[model samples]
Target chain A: MFYLLGLGILCIAFLFIIGLYNLDFKYLFMISAPAEKITAAVIIIGILNCIISILFFFGVGYLREAVKAFMEKKIFQLKTVLYFKRSGIYLSSCATLGFISRSLAIIYLRVDNNGSGFGLGYSSLLIFMLICGLCFILISHVLKESVALKEENDLTI
Target chain B: MSIYINLDKVLEDRDMKSHELAEKIGITRANLSILKTGKAKAVRFSTLEAICEVLDCQPGDILEYKAD
Candidate 1:
């Protein structure tokens, strides 16, 4: 399941990059200056999104390994715990970076367009990323506590 | 740090093997090994009772406590 999700993210990221490259550069910018500046910003945000997706792939890979370890009945193993923690950190960082990049994109769009009614979807996306990052961090802490309890139980013959 | 297991001595006195005792007590050999090696943090009352019955002894013969 995780592998499939990672693959899907990769496909979407690739399609997004392709779509960006195919867009009319000057039309998207429309900033009355050298289109280079707007193009640069677009590329930066695109690259940032691509990087976030890559981080998600790593997180998913780690989650896959953690699940496999769980099935093997090694619930409290250090490796499983480390995998979960690393994945959590990766996912949280992905969401945070995504939020930051989108915030910058929204600011750039508003400033370039003279603040004329641009959609506020970016704000919702930022909130979503924040929530997702917090959930991953919370799950990681819960897994750590469970590991500690399991270790104690195992030792108590 | 205070408790001691004299399982080895009792098993030797009874002329019994570890596997034989484990079989009679209905526990895995690995678990019995853990108990014998003093690695177990705590033993269940049922397990202790089974071990005592098999060895023809009391719990005192298997476990002892000494202040560190």
Candidate 2:
């Protein structure tokens, strides 16, 4: 629940930054500056960011449900496994979308002769997201094994 | 699937209730029910020993083999 609240705060802050402060992609999309380029690539990146945020939100919600089931001693149930699997997929989607968005941004910057400020930080962050996603998938497999073992134990008399 | 539990028959023959036998054997009613319903994957020898001791029956009398 705390994690959900934190994500909610983050999303609100992100929206405020984009709407009022006119952040990077938002400025590219909304500003009427003479030199501002409204390329299709930036629009795609914006869409990907929106998708990543929404996916994270839903994934967190599903995880909360899984935690609730765990507290109820339903750890080895099918629904728990499914919720983790879905969250894993959502995390992977976020990483993939971030990768595509960053790649497009790099290409756009290079084309516009503004490549001097491009850094490796965003790439490293995307890689971290990818690794986290793969770990979630691995955890789901472990949970599957646990479910099988639990069923066997339950049936043993 | 070939091995069959004769717990119900043995319990009936001894005029024993499921929960009563379960308590006498120091096992949970749910576990006893599982064994009686043949839903158990495998019965431990310790539990089998307890059941046989409490019900005054042999292991063979409680468990039987049936070719499927």
TM-scores for the candidates? 0.66, 0.74
Q: Tell me the tens digit of each residue's lDDT in model 2 across B1-68.
A: 88898988888999989989888878899988888888898888899889888989899998889988
Chain B vs. true chain B: TM-score for each candidate?
A: 0.95, 0.93
Off by over 4 Å in 2: A1-36, A70-74, A109-120
TM-score of chain A of each: 0.59, 0.69
Lowest summed lDDT window (length 10), candidate 2 chain A: A111-120
True contacts kept of 1: 0.52
Cα misplacement distance, residue A38 of candidate 1 (Å): 5.7
Q: Sort candidate 1 into its docking category.
A: medium
Q: What is each candidate's DockQ, to 2 decimals?
A: 0.56, 0.81
Q: How high is the CA lDDT of each candidate model?
A: 0.69, 0.71
Candidate 1 lDDT over residue span A36-65, tens digit each:
555666667767867876886787678678
- The candidate that wins on lDDT is 2
Candidate 2 lDDT tens digits, A64-91 = 6776777788888889888878877886
